[model samples]
Target: MKDMIPVDRKMSTMQDSKISARGVQVYYGETHAIKDVSVEIADNTVTAFIGPSGCGKSTFLRCINRMNDTIDTARVMGDILIDGEDIYDPRVDPVQLRAKVGMVFQKPNPFPKSIYDNVAYGPKIHGLARNKADLDEIVEKSLRKAALWEEAKDRLDKPGTGLSGGQQQRLCIARAIATAPEVLLMDEPCSALDPIATAQVEELIDELRQSYSVVIVTHSMQQAARVSQKTAFFHLGNLVEYDDTDKIFTNPQDPRTESYISGRIG
Candidate 1:
């Protein structure tokens, strides 16, 4: 596999990053969620954010695409740059930014629309396809990328919600990638799947790293070790450690990380 290379070496070799966060912090009303966290995410790599519940892992993930801005009580302070451009700049439209940075949630939240329409939603809204043929081609390509085209081909008009849990998640993945995003964010994507389906999604995640930067928030340490090149551990809203996944799991430098990994404390 392409990921066979040493992760530390891979990180050192790729000088360009898809996203950079500097002193990023998020607040929900009186609660300070993320605190002074900063990291660089390389392109075409999978980075996992692992932590116990409510440790700000998911909150920080949302900041990448400015998904946190939707909450009236949420306030983000700090610099988040995508390809050297500050995404929180006044001129950058959150809607347009989301197209470039696609996200899949913990659940398979496919639209109430048909399978075809679900995948085509982003492309249609972004005007990515010029006509019906173009739209069809894009929809096919996205479904194929998500590894769901063959199963759904005969039932394109069926409701996306009608698919099995795993299929629905893949459909959501298709919908996210239809716009051809530069970065893909996933929050506990495999949490709802069975072992077989989880394996499928994990394989798909590895394949996706070839085309886009993938950042995932997962509670499972094993999942982070399996699917991510880099892993960041968060504790009490602070970024405790960030390094190659192997290093983070095998030789974590911080005591907090070690404790968390050793099952001493969450």
Candidate 2:
């Protein structure tokens, strides 16, 4: 069973939300990919989206960082606000928005570059550093945050892709953190990793929430229950339920949520 937080603490978290969505709908060509879905994600917290395949959990996850904009036929409507600023506003630059909201994909797709360069790439393009020393410090700090500095320190000049699956994932995580993002979006970040690697990444996720709002899409109910404070269940493009992870797991309000959590559906 999952542990529950105090109701007062939950209320405080609600007031401290960092990302707010309202009436959000998404489409790819004529097919609707996401129904009207809305939720508030609190800063310094871990939120997980869980559901069966093709349920639009991943689709909704991408909306937070606007990754769907890269798809030619994709269309997103409704407001997605980060810190009260609407991201879809004409004034917002998608490129800059991406930097503030970094993403880590399921596969450990590190740049074909060296480990150090992989972490340094973001700070370089974003000009987060002024000189070589600044870039070096950023790289070290990011790698440390990802819990990979000790293992990867000596091999900084080696190719990132040459690392083990878990190491590569951690490197990707370090790369994301190097940008100093306010929110971190992870899409099945541990799906490609082994048990040990998944555990390592899960720990990293917990640590990351201490700094940034983390939103993750995962197929594993155990993973979601283990790492997330808040959980949302999606089914057939609809947000069926969202609540404290404990409530969603132990005593869901919606029948669909209860069904999914009890292994009756999904």
Which candidate number has the best lDDT? Answer: 1
Per-candidate TM-score against the hidden true structure:
0.95, 0.95
- Location of the lowest summed lDDT over 10 successive residues in candidate 2: 4-13
Shift of residue 38 alpha carbon in model 2, Å: 0.7
Query: Could you give candidate 2's per-residue lDDT for residues 1-266 as a string of tens digits?
Result: 44433333332244467999999999999989899999999988899999989999999889888899999999999999999999999999999999999999999999999999999999999999999999999999999999999999999999999999999999999999999999999999999999999999999998898888999999999899888889999999999999988778888999988888778888
Off by over 4 Å in 1: 1-13
lDDT against the true structure, each candidate: 0.93, 0.92
Which pairs of residues clash in candidate 2, taking residues 3 or more apart in a chain or in different chains? none
**CA RMSD of each candidate after superposition:** 2.9, 2.4
